[model samples]
Target: MARPDSQLLPLGDFKPSDEWQTHVNAIFYGIKGPEIHHHFQTYVSRDYRLAHALADTFLEEVRKQRLADDTITIQEWGVGNGNLAARFLSRLKSVDAAVYSHIHYTLCDYSEEILNGVRVNPNLQEHEGRYFLKQVNAETQDDFEPHSVHKIISNEIWDDLATSVLLQNNGMLYEEFLQPLLQRNIPNVPWESFVEQFAGKDLDALKKNPPFLEQIVWERSFQRIDISDWPYGTFILKHLDRLADEIPIPINTGAFQTLERAKQLLAENNLGYTSFDYGMLSDHELNLPGRPYYKLYGGQYTSMVNFPLIAEVGKAIGFADVQLEHQHDFVGRNLSENVLSALELVQVHPRISRMEPWDADLLMLQTLQALNASYRSPYKGQMDYPPMPGTPKKQRKQITELARNLSATGVPDTVAYITESEVAESTGRLKKLGYGERDLKNAFDRSTQPIAFGHMTLR
Candidate 1:
């Protein structure tokens, strides 16, 4: 139920000044500039609570294993800003001081520039002796030793871990609506012929401009691949070239071959890894088809990258104890309910609680009109008068008349008229929807929340 204000700028308005870009670079690299680090905390801390919670849960499990005294080596993949690592360590320290006494943490990211920035955080100085930061891509697993780390943690990192272009051409509706476009893209090719050529291989022909390609190569799909066997981070790129020409749709043989190669590479080691992000499940569990949570800011889709599938690949590679722990059902429900409740409060209309049939139409309309006028400009384009240049007198008069009519409708009091009932029915409705009075109070409190580094801090 964390309600962090969105840090997104309006679409098309993102022009980063040189100074700001430098600041962003510093933060992404993990250099500790207070200004940049503060902004990172403001934006990322909202979603990173999951990582913190997961770390806490993992630590609890480790304790049950009676390894508190033994060095707990944690490797965080894609540690942008190192915020998750910091938070996890902080929580661990708070929960079990003994565990913190003998822990080693390795933070890794792809960008050396960002990693340099990450090393500057004053907070990290406390753990300087025990912590290590690396400029390495998870796909390469470059200098990391096999089976060295006890636990691997990542948050929203798997979706971009390894890239692939996903061609979604299934479902009856999709075929009906989009198949024609797909057909048009192929030059006089039969559906079967097309499927045979591209089914599992990289669509090199479509690289110039894949008609249905949603994102660029770097920004394409990401699915977690198990490297528990071959090496901790070895990844072989699997090019999914597909064609759709004949019955049973000819899938490119190269795609499966590439997958097999990846499996072989991952079969060389034993590793324990866990990734958490919003994703859809392929299995039929409670009829919930998994879906990616697209970042509107980045215009990218991030999926869960099915750990079970990755585990199967691991098994194929000769790794054992590949457990796919999906804590989604428990956490997703709470997060979804919190988000829905906030949205409901924003859209709730005051007039929906009318007991009488007559109260639904005329009075409600007038009330809505008045509220709309006050919120949206009643006189947008009207000429400015002498006293109030931009104000529209006609619209103002209409609003006044509406107000008078509402008053004449025998509403008891102005406060009662607006709120609709004692304790406010909207508040009651919000509570029922899982938003407590505390949540409402917090929303109001955000307006007064102090600004630090151009971001609001609730506390």
Candidate 2:
């Protein structure tokens, strides 16, 4: 808990946003460790479908390319809870034992805390001999030999890496900078003492105390800056020249570094690098006014992945082919059907837009109930949907009943996707909830957003 509100004290001088982002994330992941999942959600955090889809795609690629080597090397960076790796291996083994026999999977993360935590997950235990864990900071890790890894995949990691925000006014480009300040009072500890502990890297001592990172407040300022010396500066500048002025554009510099590293690490007969993240997919969306460039979750800075820039970076780094599309589209390609996220399907309901928050929650649960019939997930145990605060006692009880009866096999939460056939199976139940067949048909259609889930693959 925070201490009595007090005057904010400057934690440090203003620094470039990317530098500050990297600094804060380094500290956040260092301390939060395994508990980081509580602050943010990733598609693979609880769902098995995405992992299975990726496994299928990789297997198809393996068959087509048919690498001569006896062993297949696949590395997943920024793995969360080891679920994706576990599910992927499970799918591979169940699908084809021969390919699974040659698979050598590696989990890479910057936090030893996270690595240690993933090491003990019961789900990963079944794939004991097939996987290894390595601590790697994406921005500057080079221990792996060039052309060694056959496949590299990451989910929701690029957003946490270093990104710089630029806004052009009257042809003058300005970069965002931020100064960190701490809350005046923090329980029993003095502010200065907190700073001393933070500077000394006494993470263990800090961990035993109240959350210090939560007390941070950002002070933003902008200044003209030079990027001539930065990596891919010329390429980034050329792209920025084509974009409109007065709109802040995020450049994921760290993502560019990761792409470069991926190019170096992937084998000549590789399946290549693929990452799933949330961000803008087109230049038109990036040029829109009032688009958010970054957000903070549990005091960790996360910037949008900037998919368009990433594509350019991938090509500039010598990847032969680069593809960017909606994440559901990527999953759909493997399933041979159109797909929609649970939230997207919920939004397509005819009466949803007119419903109140409580009513909307009810509708969502009903929708999930309808989808649950044939949407059985192979892996379960991550279902928890609490009713909204201020829900009436009767409605709360109704929600509880629905949640209790919700199948362990139900379509997973908002981020998980369901195929068209699954929606077809639920059509009768959905019609009672006022959804028409066309609504179900159009449920497969996804509209582009200023910001949305995106998948990028570089080959």
TM-score for each of the candidates: 0.44, 0.91
lDDT of 1 by residue, 181-269 (tens): 13223333544454443333224432333332222122122222232242222222121112221111111112223233333322122
lDDT of model 2 at position 228: 82
lDDT of each: 0.38, 0.85
Model 2 lDDT per residue over 118-225, tens place:
988989989989999999998789979999999999999999998999888887889999888876665246667767766665667667667768678989988997
After superposing candidate 1 on the true structure, give the runs of residues whose Cα lies further than 4 Å from its correct spot: 1-48, 122-126, 166-271, 283-296, 299-308, 322-459
User: Which residue segments of model 2 deviate by more than 4 Å?
Assistant: 1-4, 199-201, 212-215, 349-362, 386-401, 434-440
Instruction: Choose the strongest candidate by TM-score.
Output: 2
Per-prediction backbone clash count: 41, 0
Model 2 lDDT at residue 223: 96
